[model samples]
Target: MVNLSVATFGGGCFWCIEAVVQHLKGIEALKSGFSGGFIKNPPYREVCTGRTGHAEVIQVSFNPDIISYHDLILIFMTSHDPTTLNRQGGDKGTQYRSIILYHDDTQKEIAEQVFEEVTSLYEDPLVTELKPFEVFYNAEEDHQNYFNNNQDTPYCEIVIDPKIQKLKKMYADKLA
Candidate 1:
């Protein structure tokens, strides 16, 4: 079997993050899910209420040989507004918080290092939480590939399109 590594990131909506990362080289699978939450299996509506303590997150499975974890973490950090306490754009709530749920010690160390390197890129403090990976409750099927299917929708046009554009511009060499 081909060796692969997994990384979980939450920077606002999973849809936005997934849309950008899906195009990157070595991405084996990408899933929209809720992570860093208190519940075992959180539904979208419950997680949206913010009381579930879940943040909308994307779980990325990638080939480390092609795209290092460091690069993935750095890309994620730059793409989202990590300085915000609990929001991205107008999407507010604890569920919208920026976070990196590291899968192991190596991942955690790399994420922390990348976190420091990207801090100066922002004027405000990076509030992204770096925590151990626990569980990933997959979002409902309809939310799985929101951007690709709903590109004509306003949310995709206004929010996700720009993120896709930014990813293309910033990481041209990294795209698949």
Candidate 2:
């Protein structure tokens, strides 16, 4: 069996990130969750208030042999705007901040390098925080697979559909 690696990212709403990344090849599983927070087991309502210090993140499990972590990070950076601080589109506050939670020293180093490389592509500095992986509170059941379940919703059509299209166009070779 192939060994799977985990990468956690908070680029915006977990729904949007989860929807896009789950389509990539080698991704074994994806969970919508809250992380980098101070509270224990923060619920969606608390997280939405932005007081829990938790960012809506998705923990992605993937096989490195098929899709390297570097590739995943590149796709993530492109899928969302990393230059915006604590925000993605209409989502605002700390709960929607752009962040990458590394699982180890190697991941940290790689994340730093990737951030630097991606930074030069934009006129504004990249604000995506590179932090150590901490507790991940699984978002409530209603939040999981949100995009797939609510694709017809107005929010999904306006905010998430474009992201999916962009992913397909940019990483056609990486799709599962």
Candidate 3:
């Protein structure tokens, strides 16, 4: 309906990121997938090994009028640890690396500015990698909308649910 496009991000778990971004009002769709990785056509199993350069990411399509890039970037910065290089909480390795897959210079510029502002607040060098949008391979069907389907599951219970709660409490104003 809206002239929305995409913003792909990898903060650790795709499910968690998907949960948070999908709650945002402007986001039209959220596609849990793999990005910033080396393997071609990587699956969920392959990405878990930490060998693949890829990270669990969500491709977000959003309307700029409702949610500016700056706002989205802020949500992204708060949703995960940008200071952590190649990891987030218990998830470690390249598969968990923080990344922003920018489609154009505008996205890249906004991301860089946001990263700078965030990095200035924290002591560690923000390790979030800003990569050009290449290709996004959809994750397994089981992985899509995982938080909603698998909330009772251990990984979701232990990892994603809290993230969902956090997003809901912290960013309720942005919710759809």
- Candidate 2 wrong stretches, greater than 4 Å: none
Deviation from native of the Cα of residue 157 in model 3, angstroms: 2.8
Residues 1-176 of candidate 3: C-alpha lDDT, one tens digit per residue: 56887898889888888877877898878899998878899989998998778889989888999999888988898888889988889988888888999999999999988887777777788888888999899999988988888778898888877777888898888888
TM for every model, in the order presented, reads: 0.98, 0.98, 0.92
- For all predictions, the C-alpha RMSD in Å is 0.7, 0.7, 1.5
Each prediction's total of clashing residue pairs, residues at least 3 apart in sequence or on different chains, is 0, 0, 2
Question: Sort by TM-score, best first: what order?
Answer: 1, 2, 3
Candidate 3 lDDT for residue 17: 85
Off by over 4 Å in 1: none
The sequence of per-residue lDDT tens digits that candidate 2 reaches over residues 22-112 is 9999999999999998999988999999999999999999999999999999999989999999999999999999999999999988888
Better of 1 and 3 by TM-score: 1
Instruction: Give the distance in Å from residue 141's predicted Cα in candidate 1 to where it truly belongs.
Output: 0.4
